[model samples]
Target: MAEKQVQSRYAPDLMAGQVALVTGSGSGMGRATALEMASCGARLALFARRKEPLQETAEMIRAMGGEAFVVPGDTRDEKSVEAAMLKIKAHYGRLDVLVNNAGGQYIAAARDITNKGFEAVIRNNLIGSWQMTRAAADHFMFENGGSIVFVTAISTRTALTGFAHTVAARAGVTGLMKTLAAEWGEYGIRLNCVAPGTIKTEALGRYPIPPEKWHELNRSVLGRMGVAEDVAGTIVFLASRLGSFITGEDVYVDGGETLHMGHDARDMIHPDMFQGRQRGDGKNE
Candidate 1:
């Protein structure tokens, strides 16, 4: 296979006639992916819990001379999601792409997370994917096939601590993608996921940045901290003709961060950065 190229064409004519429904298309990676797809010739149906952001994304698409539709609602709500699907079918009469990217996360220790919190993450991450996949599958099968991309996270595989609930839920989504790919192959439906690492976006501020973690984050990967466009490009590929045969797989867009396993440089740092202090010692004290 050829190495993937990272590129974005504003208001692309490539996706000119294809239709796509992207959940959580209001902001972050979802917003970027929606724009890129629209540029490439895809008509977009943008979804989110809030109307304002969805409208903004749609407007951007329109500005790029691409067609767009704003669908505002909770994707986890099957009724709402199916209604959105119905609207798309009414407007375009065909569904070519589905991107399940709506998800939530909060910082908390595993035991500290409440049942509600855990279930909330699962509902949005896992169940929401199922709902959209089911709706899209029905329409897609009728058309003989389409592509579905799920926005997953690398933390699930690497064992991130504070987001235990999310880790579990997202891992399940990866599993779901694999199974669907197997069963839906004959129908021509392709299912895959983009596992994003740390990408700077609106969500960055919400996650609580501690100082200039940029250096750490930049060095966090062999390349650098990810930008929204990095993941967006991968999404564009998965939804385009470029990814025709690819299915039932997940790509880590984290720039080799996962490869830092036993060789984690943080551990190799001179045991002298804290000369006289023991591990976790409060130097300020």
Candidate 2:
């Protein structure tokens, strides 16, 4: 049997006449967020390093009777970001929302993390997001007043053994958003961060953990892995009028996983730590 296509609960015109830019929108959470925003009547500008995926996302949106423009560029490049913003301004004439969702990282112990790897992750996650935010503010949002959402990780709320680089970079993003929320408030620009727990996306396959282990490690209060749409709804809310007075807040969409901070150092460092343990008996096999 086919799974049912769940429709959005938000009003169809919730974001009418708004222009939203979503980075890393070629797949996973970024693509999900873009679709949701379009369903709410917002014109979308999809950004990603690859043009093919961006084109695909745009096609999907257009098929649903929504408008989308594809902008392919690396977020880490200042010139690329500036050019993208310029194109958006020229095409849309105004920007209403900016979703900084493009970032990536690999799992490695702090000792194993090299300087090159650390710098790459920071540049991609922190510096790239900051550049996009600044360009948007300078180009349109500063005077026009808009919303910005940064997609961070649940690791920012707790320590995970193999994700030293990601935790550091995302933590920086959280701090940046908080400070900007205060500084940009007078300009009518809103800034916030959305931290997702262990979401089941294509990107998850990059990790070496098995499916069952992933479930056990990420067993949140909800007792299930999150889907991309789970994070998308929260983002759409922040970018819409519903979240007008809300800013500088780091919203955790992690189904209470961050409450206990999820995994411990052992679970992350040793993937097979519980392999021989019996669940109810608490005995090693």
Candidate 3:
């Protein structure tokens, strides 16, 4: 007789009837994470500037027999964020999970970064996430506990000259996570982060790296780039019962990119002819 292989039935269904707020949840990693949480039965609260995409996410959750509420708001605006939080609280009464995943950056070298671009990135990515966390923390404190997951980038620690503003902002988020973890532990709140590596989502188009450089970006401890699921799953875990003991830590889902430290700076000086690699599989971008 053939025997079935035994596997651990470890399902962290910690979010049933729990309210989860996801920002920039219309597409890419944010959307994926929201959908995953819904699959596990958490009622979702989605925030994004675009209505159509946020609605799309809500539709997916509804299709799965899960509940979701949509709130369109600009992450960079404090009033907008507060209003969004108020709307969620009004709809659900309590929030169990908060994922600050909305972020952006101008992909230029430090020398070419403009003041406007720097300020914009800092305001939207760092300050916006801070406001969202603080607003939710006030409610969680009274409730005695909650979870927050910040979507940072592996590039923050393994510095790249092209993303100066994003790096600084995300580094600040790391520090914020640690501070809050200590401050809010008595409330049973766990604060953490997830840093993703080269992912092939819609945002990947924004990075104007040539084929050789793009390929080099994947030459990490692991040889291939990760998809949205790789990073999304980590966020779900961090916010679930499985990660109850984990906090004040940032998990990197970069397929070993940080372990590799990226390619040498001297590689940038190589002639195009010498590099002999083209973007778009030899098609000019």
Candidate 4:
């Protein structure tokens, strides 16, 4: 067989010499983004709470003749974030991009979510992203400058039932990105958020969403569920020179899901299905 041809919309060296750190890179959007960036010639620092998954991501990058460094740590912990940044600096000597993709939230109605549950989601999504962003800036981006992308949910565009906690947390991240972009623009640092709609990933399986109701999750203009690459492509664009002029923006990779938001929530959210579930028990969405 002829050697398989590889096709990419982006220049192979679009991100040459740049070092990017992607959290939650063990699988799903995180892994997809890392691989995409690597293909564009960006050295990767794979991070997540699990070492094995990070290693798996690193292996995939290596298989493609790309460079990858694994730095396993929890994004929600200040110390862990700091240590991960230090490790990335030691390994790559510089950082150019940071993708805050490490976050999770269980499906639960507002009334069923306890204060601890709410706080956990906030810490994981909002506070953890803040921590990673701050550490990256202090360690490398402050004077050198870089791009920061936060993976948020399109639910921020409209209220998402059974995901009140995540919507709130992701909304906070959106606000944080906007404010920081304004504050960091003088430093030549670009900050933005990528709010993805329901992307088909392993995390979706954890939700107990019935196969029949899965169609309801794709209530977007595209009339199809999104895949990780859908969001990963947008993120790579924002982090590359293509989006140098873009900042303080929340690009929706939702296939126009926001255009008809909440239309399917009634059919999808099964309160009973979420019963007994607590925060931190959810998988990455």
Candidate 5:
């Protein structure tokens, strides 16, 4: 429930004179990324379905003497995306970076997932993100060249259960980004992904997970729960000039959680399943 502090370890002017567009900037990771990029001195164009939250983000940035333009719209709609891009060009004259941070998913077993539910998640996560990328390229990045960072979930690597739809969509985005990286390279445009794992955000709290279960989730090699700032900083790095040579790389900002998948599941479950033989002891008893 505590508020997340906004602070970037990067130089203040790391992105000075640059214009960046961040989708889903109304709250959570998108807002965090926008704040971080603004702190790094980039002029921001914020997008989301709601205008109030987007304006709140803009106010926060402007309060810090940073510039922000709020353009509320749904990422799933091509017309909305095109209009937002046009507004960005008209207002900022150019866009140097884009953070595709808008996406949604609900937990449900693969078998229980309805056809509509699956398609909805796919539309929000994969199709919408691709549309934004294409629009950005068509409007500004194609000629000016820029950095594109897709905020994907680490579920792809860990293959987390009860969310097959989301996992598949994120995986598809990662694959699309890799292909775009190669194709966009000729234009000096770089495309990459930042995969977050178990980040402590408002969205995670909405899940049916028990409070006690959080402790188990924190068993990452880092021995801590990742905050939105952790993922946001990684995004800023990938979008900044410092990552000039990096492209098509999917960076996992998950505190090594993906690398250690299935470890916590075993710990959380009763050991009786082992039939008196504990795991990792090399005993088949």
Candidate 6:
């Protein structure tokens, strides 16, 4: 797979001496973020399910004269995550940042979603991320102190009609980050989350989105769709020393999409808008 374009403004040594472990580094936002951090001089332990794609990421990092090691493992499995962490600790000798970016969920109406489908998404997005975070904390962050960033989806804020599974999973992840921030602060481990709005990626093609829907998504105040690099920049910032004081907060990098609803209207407001009878109070039929 070709490496995603990474346009960053951080200094070359912004992450010097830092060892970061990024799950799902094979492609998509994970690969983009990994490249950005490597550009900033962070040694990377790239984790993903497939070995070939992880090798591709490692090659890209090495091409830039940066250091990276591929740790191929499924994020949903605790044993896989534990092995990845052990390998990272052995390879890098220390872990400074953990980027929980490995997650997947298919779009389905809330009413149509089956128990098996919902559970799978939860395992991939919520439990997997938590396992990685806990492993990193127990393995290195507890003693060395570090930053942990969870790459969640903006659906947590503006809940999507068809993507209930992802919305719920990401919402849980945000809650986990908030609680971890409070509990892990004493150990000097800062925890935070980054929620990205709809962004252009290879995976976007898999979704059943039409061209007009894409256009509607682009009207997010900025009048454009977000690229992977936009999210990567924020991830690099949180992983670096620049965000030392920021913790337990979520940064929405969606071009102001979450701040305002879809599109603004100029229709006049009715005087009786607030005087409408309650729905179920036996008022207006």
Worst 10 residues of 6 by lDDT: 262-271
TM-score of 1: 0.87
Writing each residue's lDDT as its tens digit, candidate 3 over 189-267 gives: 9999999888868887767766556766574556777877777788988998879999999898988777666555335
**Pairs that clash in candidate 2:** none
In candidate 1, what are the lDDT values of residues 193-226, reduced to their tens digit?
9999878788877767663675476434566688
Winner by lDDT: 2
Give a tens-digit lDDT track for model 6, residues 1-285: 454444459999999999999999888899999999999989999999999988999999988888999999988999998998899878989999999999987878899999999999999999999999999999999998999999998788776888888888999999999999999999999999999987888778788888667877664668888888898899989989999999999999998888666533222444353366434444564
Candidate 3 achieves a global lDDT of 0.83
lDDT of every predicted structure (CA atoms): 0.83, 0.92, 0.83, 0.89, 0.90, 0.88
Off by over 4 Å in 4: 1-7, 261-285
Candidate 5: stretches off by over 4 Å: 1-5, 262-285
What TM-score would you give candidate 3 relative to the actual structure? 0.85
Model 2 misplaced regions, further than 4 Å: 1-6, 262-285
Question: Model 3, residue 89: what's the lDDT?
Answer: 75
What TM-score does each of the candidates earn?
Answer: 0.87, 0.90, 0.85, 0.89, 0.90, 0.90
Better of 4 and 6 by TM-score: 6
List pairs with backbone clashes in candidate 3: none
